[model samples]
Target: MFTPVHADFFNAPTLELSRNLLGQILVHELPEGVVAGRIVETEAYMGAEDRAAHSFGNRRTKRTEIMFGKPGLVYTYQMHTHTLVNVVAGPEETPRAILIRAVEPVEGIELMRERRGKHMPMKQWTSGPGKLTKAMAINMDYYGHYFTEKPLYIAQGNPVESVSVGPRIGIGNSLDAVHYPYRFWESENPFVSKFR
Candidate 1:
């Protein structure tokens, strides 16, 4: 049985949580049942220095408020009608996060298939951020919610040792940031984002 870590675990510095979360499991409990998956892909976004980050240049707003909250919380937001999930990182007031881009489904296959609206092969089920959220039943309503407890949480799992680093995906505004290797993933993981 897997259990979630305390919120303080995720409150570490941005770079630390960003790297340590590589192999953790993100569990989503739906009314149908529990669906769990191992996180394989992530991108670190530091507060002021990262141009592609929502908190870039210290631009605070109602939407970015949760980024400043205690870490280990889900900072879900809408992007072109799709809900993208990110884990809040860094100490209080420093607004940093790790975008959960992909995951490999580890439990509740039947529930995931139903939510995806098709019987996708394992690799296709949660290969993208939006797709993973869809499979896990996560949405904007889950924004600002704590991940250590509640409908969504992260659990300790087998750590991924062989990981590859690369640039972030789909950010046209960030000219130089597009080249920064902030994204991390387990090499040979079938569920990694195809965009990279």
Candidate 2:
């Protein structure tokens, strides 16, 4: 049985939280059924000073206001046609967040497959940030939600034995921030995003 992680679970430093989430389960209790996945990859966005982050330079807008709130809050945003989910990290007033890049399907496989539509490779279902959110039915409605509660919450899973660190994907315009080794993933996980 998986136990939901409390708000304190996200109280760690942003980088640590990125790594710690490697093997955790991201559960979304949908009306159709419960869909979940084992987190395999993540990216850390150190707010304000981090040029690659949405809250860079402490810029606060309607979409980024949630990032400046308490840790463990859900920060969902749209990237093109897909909705990406992030876990608010760092202390209060700090806009740091960890983007959930990829996950390995755990529960509600049929539902996930149906939501994703058509029969494709299982790894391809949630191998990318946008793809995972689509498979799990996570959308803009989850923005500013708490990760410590039901419907959507993180749960304990297998411990990560080995981890790999690398630069995050995209955001090539962030200058030197593009080189930051802020991406963390489970070593040799096939479900991890293809970019790395």
Candidate 3:
């Protein structure tokens, strides 16, 4: 019964969103039922200067349009045939975002286990971008949707302290940009991805 308040959209800037997302609960409701997880790791992608970002250089295409939308919206894309989810950040047209890297399963554990095709321990249930989406039943169809309503949404949860920041992963081509410490996560969360 924890519904996300739409007011989260008022928060501008991807950096704030990246850090604030920690410990927030992400709920995904599908035909089967609801699956929920607590966000533990996130990466901020600033517009233009952040070379690892798709919106870098102000490049706008069919794929990145969601980045230009209002904040608190779900921006999803396909990678390796799997769906990746990001929360739009910054003001309108700013093209900033925070990629949800991992989560710790907190509710609907059975639905997550069934989606993942294995009985993973709670900590390992949603430990990666791809894994979390798969476990929550999110896909391209969810792109450009609102996170405060519909099939997927974010709800308030326990706040995390002792957070850490570091460079993003899997962006070898960005050179120095790859070293930008934009990733944020709960320091004690065991479900954080190993890439950090």
Best by TM-score: 2
Model 1: pairs clashing at backbone N, Cα or C within 3 Å: none
Give the best candidate by lDDT: 2
lDDT of 3 by residue, 164-195 (tens): 99998788898788889999999978999887
lDDT of each: 0.87, 0.93, 0.86
Clash totals, every prediction: 0, 0, 0
Model 3, total clashes: 0
Q: Judging by lDDT, tell me the better candidate of 2 and 3.
A: 2
- lDDT, candidate 1, 82-133, per-residue tens: 8999998887788888999999999988889988877568788899999999
- For model 3 the local lDDT of residue 104 reads 91
Put down candidate 2 lDDT per residue, 1-196, tens digits, no spaces. Answer: 5679877888899999999998999999878788999999999999999999999999999999999999999999999999999999999999999999999999999998887877698889999999999999999999988987889999988779999999999989999999999999998999999984
Model 3 scores a C-alpha lDDT of: 0.86
Which scores higher on TM-score, 2 or 3?
Answer: 2
Error of 3 at 93 (Å): 0.8
Instruction: Rate residue 161 of model 2 by lDDT.
Output: 99
Instruction: Work out the TM-score per prediction.
Output: 0.95, 0.97, 0.94
